[model samples]
Target chain A: MVEELIIAGFGGQGVMVMGQILSYAGMHEGKNVSWIPSYGPEMRGGTANCSVVVSDEPIASPIVTEPTTAIVMNRPSLDRFEPMVQPGGLLIYNSSLIDRAPERTDIRVIAVPANELGEEVGSDKVANMVVLGAYIKARGTVSFETVGQCLAEVLPARRHDLIPLNLEALKRGAELVK
Target chain B: MAGRKLFKGNEAVAEAAIRAGCRFFFGYPITPQNEIPEYMSRRLPEVGGTFVQAESEVAAINMVYGAAGAGARVMTSSSSPGISLKQEGISYLAGAQLPCLIVNMVRGGPGLGGIAPAQSDYFQATKGGGHGDYRLIVYAPASVQEMVDLTLGAYDVAERYRIPVMILGDGVLGQMMEPVSFPEGSEPENAPQRPEPEWATRGARGGRAPRIVSSIYLKPEELYKHNLRLQEQFKRAEAAETRYEEVRTDDAEVLLVAYGTTSRVCRSAVEKLRTAGVRAGLFRPITVSPFPYKALGERARQVKAVLTVEMSLGQMVDDVRIAVAGAAPVDFLGTTGGVVPKAADIVERAAALARHGAADQATREGIS
Candidate 1:
């Protein structure tokens, strides 16, 4: 099955890095995956999003119009991408930042307090990872162990010590969904 | 299978260039492709290679010409407007028969367009962005993996024919990340050394004659002869290197022709069309210059109609028309100014074309 997702938030929210980590985990599972960022001026404080496609077969367009899943970490991202989610798919939002819930009734909506959970896990910088953890746990998209391995690869050697905090954030968020 | 690694397209291209033994890179910064030079700057030095952040695109191309003349594997990259500035140098490189790589991560344009993905440069890339009937063997990659693979392949093709080659991508492909793998031992340290050309401008030493690397053919006859030789090389490339992919073309009632990022959208549209019980296929040109016209023309005979899709306002469509050659009517759908065409819209339009006949050329313009 193909899981096409759009992960969007403010530029510093690690939206692009979240997409990369998930795509890297997909690769570990022998899945064909692609991560396409909405780069350019959006790299500033503007809303940044990236389309992540993980599939058993070769992925077609890296540009996702109606994604099977939408992860909105901020209000603007929800306002923009909420309508683009496919019916009977999934919508995961960070309730810590977004006050309103997704209005789509056909799709399953999961509200995780990613920022709060991230702070509880020791830092708010990994709020994106918290949301990612919930999505993977709620959807079983990839295993937590695989994500751990991917984090090792994604982080630089100097920053490897932060893996424990990131793992804690991931586990904390995953626990909420569980 | 080799271990999979995540790579942004621009970074992947840099890695591939290094693996292909490219030792010199000269380029100016531009949006949608700045990562290419940035990656080169960080990595080339580690490999004992040179990366020159030239003053301008014009200087960068001349630097490429210089490095290529010295028999070093070299490359330069730019966006659409910057590419135009290098046209004169490109023509000279072709005339001098210097093998080099030029990458254009195309952005929307006729002028200084937005920093978004576009295939608008199709005409400029395939029909000689430079003057004097020179063609850069253009390879349009549809994915990040292809971005790396075709980059390695482009060097071989350029060196084989001693002509400049291009790997045409857009902002989408340049900025995207994907799992890419290279063959074992494909890294620069493990790859075979690129053999130096005998005609290189090595300085006179020991009893050897000095070579002149020049494009100035003063006499009309000499210039004509040089052009003919280039044409012969082009003819050989057309015969031997035309690359394309036919997806579900057998028993297809309608065919969608596209390349680069547009082709990826077309593939999604084809899947949607099939689900709707519309028999559709996708024809993607991997090599835009040695266009798979003959192959597509033969396939056109079976399909009821052809719908050419592009990010540009119908540039490659003209070639599709020439290739179809009245065997099947050709239609077009596109957007300009950095708006990417949607797959759902492509499916709807392609299905309509399959039901009705191909629209006339004038009417086709209306569809865009």
Candidate 2:
């Protein structure tokens, strides 16, 4: 099956990193994947998004106009991306930042209080990890272990100490689904 | 020996240049191309190679000139605006007939336009940007792999003709990531020793006398002879340095002519056109300067029409017209200021041109 996802939020919200983690996990699963970023001045304080596609077959165009999954980290992100999710697909919204849930009934919506979860985890920056945790729980696109390992591989060397914290965030996020 | 490793195109170019025995790198940092200098800064010193972050693009190109004069395998790179600054230096290098590689990871421009991918420098690259009647061998690579391969070839060609060579690319090709492999044992400890320079400024040793390398000739007759000699070398390059690639042109009724990133888009367009039952194909000129005119001219005879697609407004189209020589009608489709034309749009134009080819008056009108 072909799955496309878009992770979008404000520039410094770790949204792009969330997309990279998902793409890295997809690669770890031996799937064909591509990640394209929106760069230039559009990335500064403005809304930023990355389009990632993972497929069992070769992907034709890396440009995703309509994605199968939408991960919205803020209200603006939800407002912009909710309409582009395919019907009956998945939408993971950050309930702490987004004031309202998506109005669409055709798609499955999972409202995760990621910022509160991050606060409980002692760092609000892990809010993206909370969203990613909920995504793995909902889609089972990859094993949580694979996502954790991929995270350790992709994080900067100076931040290597954060690996255990990030893994804890992922596990705490997975437990929220239970 | 083909194994894949993920890397950005700019890093790939630096790695490939190192593998191609390029030991001297002089450049200034510019956006979209900053990764190139960043990579070289860390890697060159590890291999005992030289990497200098010049004070400005002018200083960088002149430094390249100095190194090339010393007969070192040297290179310098910058974006469009910086390349504009380097034009005078490039012209001087051409006049001196120095062998060196220069790279332009082009960004949007007419002036300091923006830091976005653009192919607007087609004319500046192909038609000698600085003053003079000289040509620099220009290679445009469509992918990261070609970026590596063509850079290696750029050095070889530069040395063979003793002329400056350019690898012209856009920001997209520089920033995008792809799998690349390092050529095995391709690194040279140093550049091959050049034959004793008859005109190099080698300082006098043991009263063997000092040689001077200058483009300045006070007398018109002397300067005229110098230019004549340069022209002869250009002629030899024109005869030997033309490179291009063709796809499905044997029975094509319409040909899509493009280069670099536009060529990849056109390739996709050609595939779509063929799927839609139109006999359309692609002709990609690898070397933009010693343009593959003979091949293009021969292909023109068999095709009904040629469509030149570029990211610039009709710069490369003129060259296509010159190469086709009225054998087939040449049409243009272009975008500018960092806009890239979609494959569907090119396919639509290709299909339209093919369907109209049979109608004589309609085709003539379409050309006009």
* Tens digit per residue, CA lDDT, model 2, B1-368: 12555567788898888877778999998887888999999999988899999999999999999988877778899999999999999999998888888899988889999887788998999899999878888999877778998987777788778889999998777875544555665655544554654555556777877665666777989989988888888778889887899988989999999987788778768877989999988999998988988899999898878999988888989889999999888999998887777787888888888866656435566854
lDDT of 2 at B79: 93
DockQ, candidate no. 2 = 0.22
Docking class of 2: incorrect
Q: Model 2, B99: alpha-carbon shift in Å? A: 1.7
Where is the poorest 10-residue window by lDDT in model 1 chain B?
B356-365
Q: Across residues A1-178, which tens digit of lDDT does each residue of candidate 2 receive?
A: 7888999888888887887787777766777666656667775568888877777765544445578999998889999999999999999898998898689999999888988998898798888888889888888877888888787667999998988878878877777775
Assess the local accuracy of residue A27 in candidate 2 as a C-alpha lDDT between 0 and 100: 69
DockQ of each: 0.76, 0.22
Kindly report which residue pairs in candidate 1 clash with one another.
none
> Over the full model, what C-alpha lDDT does candidate 2 score relative to the true structure?
0.83
- Report the lDDT tens digits of candidate 1 across residue range A1-178: 8999999999999998899899988899988899988876865578899999999899988889999999999999999999999999999999999989789899999999988889888999889888888899988888899999989888788989999999988888888885
Considering every candidate listed, which one attains the maximal lDDT? Answer: 1
Give residue B277's lDDT in candidate 2 (0 to 100). 95
| Cα lDDT, model 2, residue A36 | 59
